[model samples]
Target: MLLVDHVTKIFDPGSISEKVALKNVDLFLNEGDFVTVIGGNGAGKSSLLNAIAGKFFINDGRILIDDIEITNMPEFKRAQWIGRVFQDPMMGTAGNMTIEENLSIAIRRGKNRTLNWGINRNEKSVFEKHLSELELGLEERMKTKVGLLSGGQRQALTLLMATIKKPRLLLLDEHTAALDPSTGKKVMEVTKKLIADGGLTVLMVTHNMKDALEFGNRTIMMQEGAIIADIPLEEKKTMKIENLIQLFEKKSHTPFANDRMLLN
Candidate 1:
């Protein structure tokens, strides 16, 4: 389970530029829950994700994973239990490294390093098995440098690396936002397969309303640092983009004004 208890974050507190990014937000996710978050700019969607991931300290409240307190843990320390995929394809992987080398590091996350050669036949076979699931023929490019892969391929590989060890929580920060439409759909398919296969708990932030409704078990809408609406799978299945916009306006008591979100 994952918990965000009364969490709040403020930037430049008590100054003219002060901004409240999160406002005593409380969210709980059960095991294997896949929730998609949607919001306009400055709605604190990414702030919530960064807070849970320990990218920065929350000004108040606590964060816990499976009953263990991690509120004060450094980002690197928290990484053991958290797997993240960023929006930019280049941010998640080591471009200069070979695909196998990158996977090797991910598989060894939170483990002590040894002087032994990084890849053994057994590990290679495991890598091939995982890469084959992407069905992008990445297994054949194991020895190739990751920098040469296309944006979608690299994002797919990053997704694989993030869940290879079955992290307790996965944070996907608009991970498919950078891909072309077709490529993005392909990546989403792979994402669904992996989540089901691993029974992974995921929190995905997305701007695409169609994706928000289509992909996850539940959808949450944020506005000005608070979750104003949460629709479960049954409700979401029947909701269209127009209905979602109406619902957002009704819950937020304001017009939906984010042009980028509407355009997507």
Candidate 2:
């Protein structure tokens, strides 16, 4: 459902400080495919996601979502087919809005707004049903302001909001990295459940090696702005952590330098 062909992204081109964030990067994802991305610092993992999300125009090549070229599509325009959650818990939702109000906005994503009642009982019921699935008791607090909730709670709500209407693709940019272990695990569980329930296509960037291997159907390793290894589910199932380290070292010709990834 997604294709990135020979894409390149350079910051400060033609200058001494030019940094190639993405170097002719090529990637593809099928419908319902959940891929986890792992990389050391400056490996273009987030850049890859950003390129797909249309955060900035690529220097060259093409990007397509479900066969439609979106390389030059504005980020807001691409929201019709894309849903993303950033690393910061505070990035996805309006903190001052009530939980239900926030959900109302998500429900209306990519749709024309009109003069009407804010949220009907049926919509509230649906939101409650979805919130209940998180098992975080948010269903009972729909009227509460999002800013008052804990970080993990807010992130979980953001995940729900992002997926309320199934977009063609979901981009998870280390959505769990800022949370504590147990809370992160909870959010991951919710993520898996929602993705599976909707058969969603997903690309998630994560620094935690164990989470990378455990969550997605495919795992990709990046280095120096390009993909170095792509491990399919069957291979990843048999792949040991030690073997993965060895593979990265062999492929990149350098030891993996992300201590947070290794320690996780």
Candidate 3:
């Protein structure tokens, strides 16, 4: 469903501080594939997602979603086919908008704005059903402003918003990183449910090795802006954190050194 071909992203091209965030990186995801990305600092995990989302145009290469070229498409235009949730819970939703209001915006993403601004009964019913599946009692508080929600609640809601329309590709950038362990786990559960229900194609970058291995059918390790390891489902099933670290050292010729990733 997604193809990233020989993509390279270089920041500050001719300057002394020039950094290549992506180095001819190539990746492909089949429809319904859920791939988890892992890497240390400067490994280009988030950079890959940003490139795909067109936060900035890449210096080289092509990106396609379900056969349509989107390499040079503007971010707003790409939103029609891509849905993303950021690391920061506060980044995804409007704080002042009520729960239903925020959902209404998400529901209308990439669509033409209509003259009628009211949420119809059918739309409200759909929102209630989806919120109820989160099991957070958000269905009962649809009138509450999103700003009043706790971090976990907001993140869960963000997850729902991102998937409400089932975009062609879903980009989850360390989505559960900011929540408490217990809350993060809950959000992950919701994430898994949403992905499974939609049969969505997903690329999730995460620092936690355990989550990376446990959650996805495939796990990829990146270093210095290149993908060093891509473990398929069968191989990933037998892999553990230690095995991943060993593989990283083997391929990158450097010890796994991200403390945040390790300690998590």
Candidate 4:
């Protein structure tokens, strides 16, 4: 359902500080495929997500979603087929808006807006149903402002909002990185439930190796802007974190150096 062909992205080209964020990277995802991404700092993990999301135009190559080329499409235009949750909990929703109001916006994404009545009983019921699945009692607080919720609560809500309409692809850019470990685990559970329920195609970038291995059908390791390893489902199922670390060291010709990833 997604194809990234020979993609390359370079920042500050022709300057002394030139850096390559993506190095002719190519990736493909079948429908309902969930892939987790792991890499050290500046490994192009987030850059890959950004390129796919059209945060900036790539220097070269093509990106397609559901077989339609979106290489040059603007970010807002690509929203029709993509849903993304950012690293920051505050990035995805309107803090001042009520929970139901935020959900109303999410449901209307990529659709023409009207000045009709804000949210009907049916819509509220739908919101309640979805929020109830989070098991966070948010269904009873639909009228409460999002800003008043806890970080984990808000991130869970963001996950729901991102998948409420089941876009063709979901990009999770280290969505749980900012939460406490316990809350992060809770959000990850919500994320898994949502993806499974929707049969969603997902690309999740995470620093936690165990989470990377445990959550997705496939796990990919990146280094210096290139994909060094792509472990498929069967292989991933039998592999331990220590095995993954060994593989990384083998492929990258360097010790696994990211202390944050290692500690996680």
Models, CA RMSD each: 1.1, 0.9, 0.9, 0.9
Worst 10 residues of 1 by lDDT: 255-264
What number of backbone clashes does candidate 3 have, counting pairs of residues 3 or more apart or in separate chains? 0
**Clash statistics: count for each candidate:** 0, 0, 0, 0
Q: For residues 35-122, what per-residue lDDT tens digits would candidate 4 score against the true structure? A: 9999999999999999999999999999998889999999999998899999899989999999999999999997777755389999
Query: In model 2, which range of ten residues has the least summed lDDT?
Result: 255-264
Ranking by lDDT: 3, 4, 1, 2
The lDDT of each candidate is 0.93, 0.92, 0.94, 0.93
Q: State the lDDT at 74 in candidate 2.
A: 98
Model 1, runs deviating above 4 Å: 262-264
Which residue runs of candidate 4 sit more than 4 Å off their true CA positions? none
Model 1 residue pairs with clashes: none
Error of 4 at 15 (Å): 0.9
Candidate 3: which stretches are off by over 4 Å? none
Cα-based lDDT at residue 199, candidate 4: 95
Instruction: State how far residue 171 of model 3 sits from its true place (Å).
Output: 0.3
- lDDT of each residue in 1-264, candidate 2, tens digit only: 899999999999999999999999888999999999998887898999999998999999999998999989999999999999999999999999999999999999877777453799999999999999999999999999999999999999999999999989999999999999999999999999989988999999998888888888999999999999999999989888778888999999996667867546
